[model samples]
Target: MRIIEPVEITPALAVMEAFLVQPSAEPLVVQVGQAFQVASLLTNVPEADHPVWLSTKSYAVGDVVMLEHRNYEALVANTNKNPAGVGADPPNWLDLGPTNRWRMFDDKIGTQTTNPESIELTIAPGRAVDSLAFFGLDAASIYVRVVDPYQGIVYESSVSPVSTDGINDWYDYFFTPVEVNEDFVLLGVPAGSYGSIEINIAKPGGTARVGALILGKAAVLGEALYGTSVGITDYSRKDRDDFGNVVIVERGYSKRAEFDVIVQTSQVSQVQRLLSKYRAKPLVWIGEASYQSTILYGYYKEFNLVISGPTASDCSISVEGLI
Candidate 1:
């Protein structure tokens, strides 16, 4: 899986700039939106940034736009119809957002620890997020905390945690493109407070494995962001009224986005191993503007492959998003 790095912000004032420039024992300090600016700057970004969705005009391929809290792209290209209706057609539009719940996780930290029975991820986001989610965490009495450079520990989990096998009753089933069918839980932080977020997980037992992590405004993607991007066959419902009249309610979608992943037969195992790392956790799809917004959560819905006589050939796998 490709790692998405955070952006760098252009400090608004000289004092903040000096604080950032000078390495110190003190925690880094900055206001909100600055970290977002930095993250946006240090990347091979798009030449033409699309406008946030609008309804008054027409759109073409590669033209970015957002609607109803989701971003989208014109896949097949059409004019009058809205993006909400557009998502119903798999061949027409695509949704994009922070689908990868673990995008904020720094994989460089190494996902597990045994010597200390814990792992601390040093994150300097320069902003505050409402909640974060964890997937496939195998630990007993897991303790979590978020420390700010200036304020000490701002967020921490007091409730004793159950092992991964015992969490079916507590955690929600979050999806990740590479990883499929795993247990995950979302943690909420204090309200109206901001900080440079650093997550610390401590387990008393010998070994602890951190599967994946996601940080953002919404604790749950399926709730905060949910819509169909492709393979939506039907989205209509009907009910009978008191007088026997028909009533129809249009909800969201029967979402199932499918895509073929082609790889050589020799690399099949490698791809599978990488996919297994995610193990059914939500992934961020930053492929395009629209795809990033709507397909906030996805999984290895299904896959198929036919090896042709030991030589390098195409092995097809399909990705499915929130059902």
Candidate 2:
């Protein structure tokens, strides 16, 4: 078993590719017998093009601006009004939520960053990174490339998320819903200074969405015992209507797990330090490398350790995931 200590990709550490779609600065066309022209609308603007909310600038209706990591659109033409400040009783701005370029990095797994067909980014960690994990993915495949300054492209690999498991019989193959992996990890990134990692996601004819990306060095905790357990915490609601019929309200769910591990006595301090350092932070906990069900991206609820012998100790942990 191993835990990946995540590296936060701040604005200084990486640069995301520009979102493919952007609103035109000018009207797209002039309509006949109409007083207003068809103006191009902005979807997600690039960092360079994103306009910051300025108290000295006057805004017109349908204008968008950024303030405090969130985007807001002007509901009515106004001047010197702060979008984030509480001035008017009902403010003249409508909250548009986080920008598409930063949705994936916001630590909210349910809010995904999406783009048509594909999404790409380049990042420099300034340190060695051995593992990269993705969660809440809605893409066909992932490609990773590492480049070293002296040797050029040092390593590259790609993997598909589509899973063809549980298709034993002919009928099952045809009737079963197509299942794909929602989370995946890429390992063995070459270690080098002045190097960068380039990631690309491809989903032809559909939106390529990613909720969160974790890049870090993995630390071995212990050997995950065979009796580890995994399940989900569902939030769906089911109620009986007046007509005695069942009514279901669908909602999201989060994965959960409980596991035991055996670790060397000498490494107890190291393991405890790692756990303490990331107690409140989310991380990739890999229980068994070959089994996809055993890997969870979340925080540990609780953990206890007991010294069993002179050389080894027994540890138990429970983890709860972010939706």
Candidate 3:
């Protein structure tokens, strides 16, 4: 998503990744320049990012992925033994609701091989990926090789004989962190002269079903969309003059709105850092400002000046809306 900043500053693009976690847990979305405070993102370990759309991998219910330039959540997860060719939409994936971002393909092609399958993923041209996450079932082994654009094989390792038995038995395999400034990354059972692009997302030949393949660390704040202690910090209405006396025009809110928010948490830094990364993006606020709406979207605020004392609970945040 793109974020608009103040007239004095230029706009910035917010890079975000989507993922599926336990049904009970929330998925975290990363903002541009946010500190690596989350353990998953901070730890030099490979972890799941979001569910990967493995053309040949299988998925179950409640999984997530980005397909065809859209976010989708799986509902009734079922894989088609025979899937369509590349660039074709499979079957059975759905959006979260009448208005949602989750999606799934109706038909998923099964991996033809029972051995290691290779998947090659490419990072953005100038971007670097630090970690890799693997989620799946019934994989006997997972071998990872990270190659640089110029230098080959910067990092390599393999976990033989993964623990999970099958799709019914969900499990995950995380890799250690590595430097991936190169544009390409190769992952899967040992590529071993597969005659494929080594740096891109590579999957070894295998029948093992891959549920999710996140590239970065886990999002600790989850969505970072909700907050507490909200109140109308400022308000104004429109008025016009008609004839001799002034008359009130329709009471319209200003594009520039303000709100006082207090975030209560054991970790004040978490809330503070979240607000900082949230700068210059469209944010949703739910409270009196919403005015009969569950959420008031299209607000942008710069980094909040957090007031923290001895305890993690005492934290203050002021949100500045768009004008």
Query: Which model scores highest in lDDT?
Result: 2
Error of 2 at 59 (Å): 7.6
All models, RMSD in angstroms? 22.5, 11.7, 21.4
lDDT of prediction 1: 0.42
My TM-score estimates for the predictions, one after another, are 0.32, 0.77, 0.27
Identify the runs in model 1 with alpha carbons over 4 angstroms from their true place.
Answer: 1-116, 147-153, 163-182, 191-194, 219-323
1-323, model 2: which lDDT tens digit per residue? 98888877644433333222124323222223322211111123244325999999999999999887678999989988888888686679988877777777777678788888888776666567889888888899899898664467899998898766788899988998987677777777876544667788889998999888888898889999988899999999999999999999998888899988999998888888889988999989988766677778899999988888899999999998888
Kindly report which residue pairs in candidate 2 clash with one another. none
Q: Give me the candidate number with maximum TM-score.
A: 2
Q: TM-score for candidate 2, please give it.
A: 0.77
User: TM-score-based ranking, best first?
Assistant: 2, 1, 3
Better candidate by lDDT, 2 or 3: 2
* Candidate-wise lDDT, in order: 0.42, 0.78, 0.33
Order of quality (lDDT): 2, 1, 3
Off by more than 4 A, model 3: 1-126, 164-206, 217-270, 275-323
Q: Look at candidate 2 and tell me the lDDT of residue 142.
A: 92
